[model samples]
Target: MDANGHVQPYIINKNMGKPMADFAPELPKKNADGVPIVEPTDEQKYMFDADGWLLIPNVLSEGEVEEMREWVKRLHFDPESLPDHERTILAGPTQRLIDHPVVMGMLNEFTANPALSSQECYGFSLGTCGYWYRTAPNRRTEGLKEARAFKPHNGNGLYRLPGDVHFYNSFPGKSFCPHMRVVWELNPVKYKQGGTLLVSGSHKAVYTAPDEIQDPDSDVWTTYECEPGSLLFFAEATTHSAHPWTNEENDRIAVPTLYNQVDGGFAEALKPDEKLLESMPPLRRTLFRDRYVANNVVGADFKRLWRV
Candidate 1:
């Protein structure tokens, strides 16, 4: 309590320690114009409107990329000792390479950049969970023929079909779970090494042609050729598929991590378990809400302010 007699903002702990309450660090109030003073840059803003992808070149250093490649090679060659899902086994200098300050700093800078709007970074390990081509133990005559033709939809051993291929929608929607994916290519792209194939503007398409309706000669899709250390970011709305590596002798690998704009207000509505939310720091909670809260009034005010 103060001399004015107004109630102070503080919380009492059960252990009887000093009352802890975060009162400072309030976000700047929306201005009279109602437009956020800090908006995304032209290139960042274009991501949401146009192609729905951003390719960052040389995000990882050559040495770091090589270390990741070596790690993947070790994992692939030793089938009996592969790392389980979420279980990481960093060998030799690979562990240090991944945990290097530079790598950590880059990740933090990219994820926390104002252009991304306080988005949460979801990390994925390509070494553990990348899509791979697996052949059946005993190939049938039809399978061999289908493989030779390079058919995209044939359930042959050459290619493993993605579980779902639909337009962007929320979680319940088949394509929603994978809102975004970042590919960290470990190996340098060569002419015929089977890199990921993607349709440049397919993410903007409202409808996807059925498998039976696809034309063999259409140029709707093209393969993504990139160097090691390059990062390819794409939205799940895109019509994309993986090409099989004809060179079985040399393994190709990439790691991907997904992140979404925190300011979009989607994360707040889809809050995980209550326990998890409660455990998070107050600043995180406040920042998340400030960025993600859907303020209908704010939108209306923005329109009136800007006459847009």
Candidate 2:
């Protein structure tokens, strides 16, 4: 098997050896408007394939970080100024975060459906977006806290239908994770301050996870510290959860944007409205288009499937 040069049979052989897809050889390098694409370094790619997540430190400049924070703050504190529905969505320059250079590059390789091309569309869509803020009920815990703001869920090894968008696959020139997540930290995320949680490498596992690993004490759960403006990209196939926000003085302010293949989206309510789509360039607006099957699909039983 020429792992380096050849595409191999991937992922559906009864789990005899569900190899972890090597993510480096086929990362899509796509850029944002006026911004050059930020390709993942070799080490970063290796870490992403191995751990199912990667943190690109300071991907946004200090000034950019400050500006984004201000926008988010307005959305948070000045909710009354904006309608309820608008409060949770990106506003002003923050809307550009959907196709930010760093994020687009990763989405191209990870979630973008290779079946499609950039010439036609991004191959992925912004399924939803939201920010989370929290203040600890009491003093921040010095060690891992048992109380999780959100329970860990969704990983590759777990049982899922083949049609499930949150999937992981690999071959010679590309890897596929039809659904994924990107988190932009507006505030500093310290080691124990709590942001997001993930079970390292769980995305590629073929076996069901045991109850023990879900506990915060498992030591298998991984999180890291980074300055403001850091971007965290991860596969939805990874077992991930929200760690309790323990920073009381400030707040744990983070924006998480979910993405899925262009053919389908996960969050219908967050789908972009007509006016918003009309305002965006044709290409960028593809991120919010409705779900539809492509004109061409080979050997697929369309009628027998998706009866619902």
**TM-scores of the candidates in the order shown:** 0.46, 0.77
The segments of candidate 1 whose C-alpha lies over 4 angstroms from its true place after superposition are: 1-41, 44-49, 79-178, 191-193, 207-217, 247-250, 258-308
lDDT values for all models: 0.39, 0.67
The residue-by-residue lDDT of candidate 2 on 99-201, one tens digit each, is 8877877776566553443433555778888776555658544432343566888786334567676667766545667667899987888886686888888
Off by over 4 Å in 2: 1-32, 83-88, 138-150, 158-160, 295-308
Q: What is the lDDT of residue 74 in candidate 2?
A: 80
Q: Itemize residue pairs with steric clashes in candidate 1.
A: 265-292
Evaluated at residue 29, the lDDT of candidate 2 is 43
Worst 10 residues of 1 by lDDT: 119-128
Best by lDDT: 2
- What digit string (tens of lDDT, one per residue) describes model 1 on residues 1-308? 53335343343333355543321111222211232223233464344335545565666788877777766555545544643431232233333332233222222222321222222221111112242222222332232211222344211111223543323432110122224555666666554346655555555554544553253335765555667777666654555555555544344566644433343412222332345436443323322233332332221221221121
